[model samples]
Target: MQVFVTGTAGFIGYHLARRLLEDGHVVTGFDGVTDYYDVSLKRSRLAALQQYPQFSAIEGRLEDAGLLSETLERAQAEIVVHLAAQAGVRYSIEQPQSYISANLVGTANLLEAVRAHKPRHLLMASTSSVYGGNTKLPFSERDAADAPISLYAATKKSNEVMAHSYAHLFDIPTTMLRFFTVYGPWGRPDMALFKFVSAILAGQPIEIFGEGKMRRDFTFVDDLIEAMIRIMPLRPELGQPLQGDSLSAVAPYRVVNLAGGHPELLMDFVAAIETALGHKAAYTIKPMQAGDPRETAADTALLRELVGDLPRTPIKAGVASFVAWYRQYYRV
Candidate 1:
């Protein structure tokens, strides 16, 4: 299958595109390569994909309305996977406009392109941040995601609404995967694991937010990619009730929680990283910031039912793999 994938320069996108190419699928990657992190990392990811004959990449923002349509037509994409977005919760507090432009406006444009082209399967990403302040121990697909604590989460929730509208009106088969705290090799710099690893390696004190009380369902990139590909041909049908909730009854779209379904404490995760790097982190405990949740755990039953199993990469192994990659990438 020929696939059109956005954010091929990103961490998950880079891994996903490589896996797809390895499986003998032709992929057209789209990315803006914003200086959200290191542009060098993005370029390196693209360079790796360039080694594969089946991979093609486009450098542009997703909000570029005309560009997306033209690329979809030119690539003759039968499957569309949209992963590009302005990510970061704390960063959203300062750069709210970035979230609006990429998450909201950009997503709307992608939906329009899908409506025009009518891909067989349209899988876009959502986030566990949408769960908001709800004290739900393990968030399920049926739970209410109406209360988003951060603008980033709100925009992602808005994407779900926008995608559902397109799916319902245009009869587009769409699936939205609510990703948990995803991390691994080629990970984003803004993410906790990356920051912690960088600080520890430099002998700098790591900020332990909320007095190190936060826990997250950190899903490995490869496991998440596996779940995503397995779900490609399992797009939900219209008129089917959404699992756990009936909020999306009008659309042929359903939200699936993609995670390891296990929440690990922040300190525990950091300990694993410290072990991997053979160094302990100097901790500076700080209060939690605005729009941040205390904890997150995924109820991936729906995803399991759809894909027969969910990703189960243990945190220790995942951390070790990331540490090895970080050492090699930076020559630490």
Candidate 2:
């Protein structure tokens, strides 16, 4: 299958594109490679994908609707995975306009491109942050996720609704994946795990949010990728919602959580990193930052129903793999 993937320079996008190429699928990667964190890291990821003969990439912004449309037409993609966006909660608070342009307008353009092209399967990313103000122990697909504390989460939530509208109107098969705190090798620099690892390796103080009381359903990137691979072919049908599924009754669209279904404390996660690096990290506990959640736990019962088994990468092992990659990547 020929796949059109956005954000190929990103951490998840890089890994996903590589896996698709390995599986003998032709991938047309698209990324702007903005200097959101480190452009060098993005270039390195793109370089890795360039090694594959079946992989090709485009350097452009999603805000360029004409380019996106032309690229989609040229690729003639059977499947489309939209992963490019302005990510980061605190960053969203700081640069709310960036989120508006990338997450909102950019997503709107992508949806228009996909709607015009009409791929067999359209899988875009959402976030667990949408489950804001829902103090439930484990969040379920059946739960209402109307409240979003951060602009980033709000934009993602808007993406879900906007995609549903397109799915219903255009009869497109769409799946919005609500990802938990995903981390592993080739992780984003702005993520907590990467920040912690960098600080620990440099013997710098690692800032702890919520006074180290936050817990997250930290899903490993490999596990999340595997789930996506298995789900790519499982497109939803109209008026055929599964039992307890988040599938829309009106459209052939559903919102699924890609999570480990296990919540680990922030300190426990730091401990896993410490154990992996064989070094103690200096901690600076502080109040929770805006647009950040206190705790996140996924009720992946519907995910299990869809994919049979859940991703079970332990925190320690995932952290260890990331640490090894970090050491090799930075020679630290």
Candidate 3:
């Protein structure tokens, strides 16, 4: 399969591209390699992907409609996975324009390109953050996600609607994946696990938000990738809705939550980090930051129906894998 994946420089994107390359698929990666965290990290990911003979990349922003369309048309991709975005909850508060440019305008350009060259399936990365302000214990796809607390979540929700409109008009088979708290090896530095491990290794105090009471359905990267790969071929079709589905009535599009359905406490997650690093992390309890949810738990009923029961990696093991990767990557 010729797969076109955006955000190949990102954590999940790098992992996904590597898996596809290993599976003998010709993959064309697209990334802006933004300096959101560390340019070196992004470059290192790209360097790793460059080793594959079947892997190629384009270093450009999604806002460049001409380049994006040209690249997509040339690739003749059978499958398209949209993962690139300005992807931080707190950062969106400070840099709202960046989110607008990347998530809004950039995604618009990608949709235009897709409209020009229709693929068999178009899978996009949405977030559980779209379940914002809803006190629902386990958020289902059928639940109302009209209220998003942050600009980042709002943009993602906008992406869902935007993609839905495209699917309805163009008959594009699209699936929107609402990811929970995803963590694992080669993870983002801005995420909680990375920050905690880095701070602990540096003998610094880690900040505990929501007084360490926040719970999250943390999905390991490998598990998320597996679910994504399986769901790739199960694109939604008009009038073919499954039981407990978020499938659209009018469009060939649906939303699925990619998660383990098990919510773990924040402090328990910290304990897993401590066990993984073989050292306790000093910490200060702090109030939850604005635009941050107290907890995020996904109802993955639709996910299970699409892809058989996924193997959920234990937090301890996942943390250990990430700690080892972090130590070796940083030579800590």
> Which candidate wins on TM-score?
3
Clashes in model 1: which pairs?
A: 142-244, 142-245
Clashes of 1: 2
TM-score-based ranking: 3, 2, 1
1-332: candidate 3 lDDT, tens digit per residue: 99999999999999999999998999999999999999999999999999999999999999999999999999999999999999999999999999999999999999999999999999999999999999978899999999999999999999999999999999999999998999988889999999999999999999999989999999999999999989988979888889888899999999999998999999999999999888998999999899888888888778898888999999999999999999999999
Candidate No. with top lDDT: 3
Query: All candidates' TM-scores?
Result: 0.97, 0.99, 0.99
Cα RMSD for candidates in order: 1.4, 0.8, 0.6
List, residue by residue over 93-186, the lDDT tens digit for candidate 1: 8999999999999999898888888889899999999999889779987888888999999999999888888888899888898999999999
Please list the residue runs of candidate 1 whose C-alpha ends up more than 4 Å from where it truly belongs after superposition. Answer: 240-247
Worst 10 residues of 1 by lDDT: 238-247
- Tell me how many clashing residue pairs each candidate has: 2, 0, 0
**Deviating ranges (above 4 Å) for candidate 3:** none
Tens digit of lDDT per residue, candidate 2, span 1-332? 99999999999999999999999999999999999999999999999999999999999998999999999989999999999999998898889999999999999999999989989999999999999879987999779899999999999999999999999999999999999998999999999999999998888999998999999999999999999999999998977777788888899998899999999999999999999999998988999888788999999988888989855899999999999999999998
Clashes of 3: 0
lDDT values, one for every candidate: 0.90, 0.93, 0.94
